[model samples]
Target: MRPPTRLARAGGALLLAAALSGSLGGCLSAYLGTAPEENSPTAPPSAPPGPRTTAPTGAAAVTAAVTVTIGNFLFQPANFTVRPGGTVTVVNGDTVEHTLTAQDRTFGTPPIAPGASATFTAPAQRGDYAYLCTFHHFMRGILTVA
Candidate 1:
């Protein structure tokens, strides 16, 4: 067969470049933690792979003084109550950095790296405070200070 024409060679180069760019884009997104995981809130819930916490059985057993676990892009014990101005511990169990920020600016924690932890004091006021992860807004929880 005759050698490929100039147009054919250019087309092949363009196709190769497009494929390389697409693959690089995917790698970058994964590295930046922008790629959605299977357990993301937008997807149907699946059994998380790890030890799980059981809900308290009685009202008296309920306690917000426990540590908040972040994994699978979710906040375990998504709602709880604590004493006013009480310090709350947040554990980042996911593979990405996360922040627990109050919607009303009452309380928040700086970015907690994966497997790291941080703490923030609850507002002294008695009310329900909604919070979310600054990096992943869909990951939300409620803090009640009573």
Candidate 2:
């Protein structure tokens, strides 16, 4: 048989590329974290595992005046209330260290090691604030200043 023409070879390459792109698109959920730059080459084999999440059952919401717990890879009482400019303490119950990284830079804390505690002063704006563990950066929670 005659070898394929140059036009035929180009068409085959385009068909192969289309098929590969379609397959990769279906696996986007595996990369659920913050989307990086479009041309960045630092992606994982799968959607680099995300943080463990939990809904606030009000479990630690009332503990010892605005104290929350960080243990078992979750933020107990995923949300809590605080007075404007009041203190919000985080008590770490896990062996690993954690942080209360303010998403808005309103407040933050140094590392709170296992069985330790750290406090962040609530913003004075009477609004809800979001935060996460700088260490985990996925263990998220909220603080409401009213």
Candidate 3:
């Protein structure tokens, strides 16, 4: 065959080989369940177990405090459940100011001073109440009265 014709044939063979190799590689990967390097080998550990509460010893049982920490513009216990008419003392340990305003019946503290504490008694009904820090819109929490 002429030089030009031979060169064209060689180029076509190389192209066909490259295409076959790519398709075979894809099929092999799918069969082996091999993922890219970034894919984690195993699912990351789940979040630590739920919040742990210290049971009241003696008189403390009568007056239990469900502390809702406020820091980094977040409520540590973003969601919590409490017995109706129970007492919830929200302590603001953050350096910034925070407020706990109830969505409905004004069942919240005025502005809990930073490094200071304030308490609010739940109503006599069962419902989910959302609270937030008016000063910082991002700070929010939920109180499930049961």
Candidate 4:
């Protein structure tokens, strides 16, 4: 058999390069997307940005710590509400990992390995917030504050 010609070798190299760049592009986007903007300075520490309030701890303390479990390719209690200024604890009940991501970029968790959990303060407002498991498109949920 004859050795590959220049054109063939160039084509192969181009294909390999394209494939690598496609995958690496994804990685770069993910990293850049999550990184804080270098040009945008953070807000003053004395003045907090969002309507951050302490999670209620009172007669509603028992209900204040809400839990959203992830398993079966689903967010158990796919829809639920909690009082404003409360805590939402996302528990990964599945054998595989999961993520609790807010569509509005208001909040989210890094990958929660199986049986692990992440907790964040609910938005201090009275409205509906939609979220999803970034890893699983079909896995979604709603958080309501009223």
Q: On residues 1-146, what C-alpha lDDT tens digit does candidate 4 reach at each position?
A: 99999999999999999999999989998887755555657633354577868656454533566888887989888987777778988999899989878898787788999989998888887788999889897898888777
Error of 1 at 21 (Å): 52
lDDT tens digits, residue span 1-146, model 2: 99999999999999999998887766664666457666678854456678988645463433335778888989887888876677778899999999887898769889998999998778878677898888897799888776
Tens digit per residue, CA lDDT, model 3, 24-105: 9899998997754555668555577998897653443433347777777788788876777888877788887788778664
Q: For residues 51-121, could you state the per-residue lDDT of candidate 1 as single tens digits?
A: 77975545555355658999999998788777777789999999999988998776899999999999988
Give the whole-model CA lDDT for all candidates, comma-separated. Answer: 0.86, 0.80, 0.77, 0.83
- The residue ranges of model 3 lying beyond 4 angstroms of the native Cα positions read 1-64
Q: Could you give me the TM-score of model 2 versus the true structure?
A: 0.55
Q: Local error of candidate 4 at 145, Å?
A: 0.7
Tell me the RMSD of model 1 versus the true structure. 13.2
Which is superior by TM-score, 2 or 4?
Answer: 4
Error of 1 at 57 (Å): 13
Give the higher-TM-score candidate: 1 or 2: 1
For model 2, how big is the CA root-mean-square deviation?
13.3
Residue pairs clashing in model 4 are none
Worst 10 residues of 1 by lDDT: 55-64
What TM-score quantifies how close candidate 1 is to the native fold? 0.57
Query: Of 3 and 4, which scores higher on lDDT?
Result: 4
Q: Give the local distance difference test score of model 2.
A: 0.80
lDDT of 3: 0.77
